[model samples]
Target: MEKPLMIALDFPDLDQVRQFLAQFEQTDQLTVKIGMELFYHYGPAVVTTIKQADCDIFLDLKLFDIPHTVEKAMEQLGALGVDYVTVHTLGGFQMLQAAKKGLSDGAKRAGLPKPHLLGVTELTSISEQVLKEQQNCRLDMNNQVVSLAKLAKDSGCDGVITSALELSDLVKSVGTDFEYVVPGIRMHQDAAGDQNRVATPKDARKDGASAIVVGRPITQSNDPEHTYQRYLKSWTLK
Candidate 1:
């Protein structure tokens, strides 16, 4: 329960979000991720609703652009008081630094602590084939993920969103001082769906992931709260 667990709330609207969250008790201290869809549909207002629910927010837009533009955008996003925000690791050092500075500056203006800046490495949907043929990246998937993670660590990112398969290598390569928020998590009974490199919560924990994101396994379950609690139990098991 103490370990960070982020549930991906990929719903497109606030009403559905409320309905889903209402299933949980009021005392629950949930940490949820708001990806591009909800944010695009409802804008900053979505963050307000999440905050009102007494939940920690992971604003996972995966911002990627020139340094100046990203910096400015992060400034606005940071003011929403989210616990974490993401940038594309491929954006390079200057952009990452700009994101951190912009986030800290905006947070200060709003009298809130700066949200952690997470760099998104290779997405879980990407495989070796996709990396080599589609993106045309010379480095293999694991090497590229580790490389981007190291760059992110040096460039002021507090953590990275990498798959659990690369989590151990990330810890070994980048050191434990950086956070590793792994996604593409699926239990044994869950379908892989579009994910290419998914792992169980136990695998992620064993590999030294600082946090983990679970979407459909819980979100799409017949009983979301029960599924979430069950996963949380497994996540903490010795």
Candidate 2:
């Protein structure tokens, strides 16, 4: 079975992605995330190139925009044949609905496979202090996260992007229909760096996250494969 983990190939260049992939075998069953840094650099063609090598792709553009614009963009992204895509839930109800509709429509028009559309709540980099002080949002961190997850689900998203710290409350509040794809995951031994709401792979799985996104913990390691395996093994344990 494929591991319930998607490695973020966050390289700014396609060459780096290629070099990393070359280290693994064809039948390795890895799902790769092409986030903004890589996507902005390589574009949709990079998606096609990676899939041709037999890896499922998660296109994490984290798009946030007006309803009409975001909807239209999702139409194009759906046509690219990615397995999953994301938008910011903070964009409001209209944008989320438009995105859902647009992706569905795109699937019908082009006979393309519809990707699982996820809503990004707060970024893992954001802190409760920032929400209260900088953004003037009064909700506590956990409450704010649950509120957004609920909105994202009500808005027709199939899943959410959040840290594992908030996963339990989200699952309790919203039920299991919405998949939780937790990012900001730091391996137990890894540096926390800029991420604030981080979790180890085991914790994320225990909290019922459907998938976890790991970037620097693996990519920046001296042994990328070994680091990836550490995440894989952690998730695989019963």
Identify the candidate with maximal lDDT.
1
lDDT of 1 by residue, 1-238 (tens): 3467899997878898999999999524789999999999989999988898899889999999999999999999878999999999999999999999999989999999999999999999999999999999999999999999999999999999999999888889899898999899888989999999999999999999888999988888899989998888878788
By TM-score, how accurate is candidate 1?
A: 0.98
Q: Model 1 Cα displacement at 50 (Å)?
A: 1.2
lDDT comparing candidate 1 with the true structure: 0.91
lDDT of 2 by residue, 15-83 (tens): 888888887765248888988887787688899889887888899998899999998998889888888
Q: Model 1, stretches more than 4 Å misplaced?
A: none
- Which residue pairs clash within candidate 1? none
Candidate 2 displacement at residue 33 in angstroms = 0.7
**Which lDDT values do the candidates have, in the order given?**
0.91, 0.87
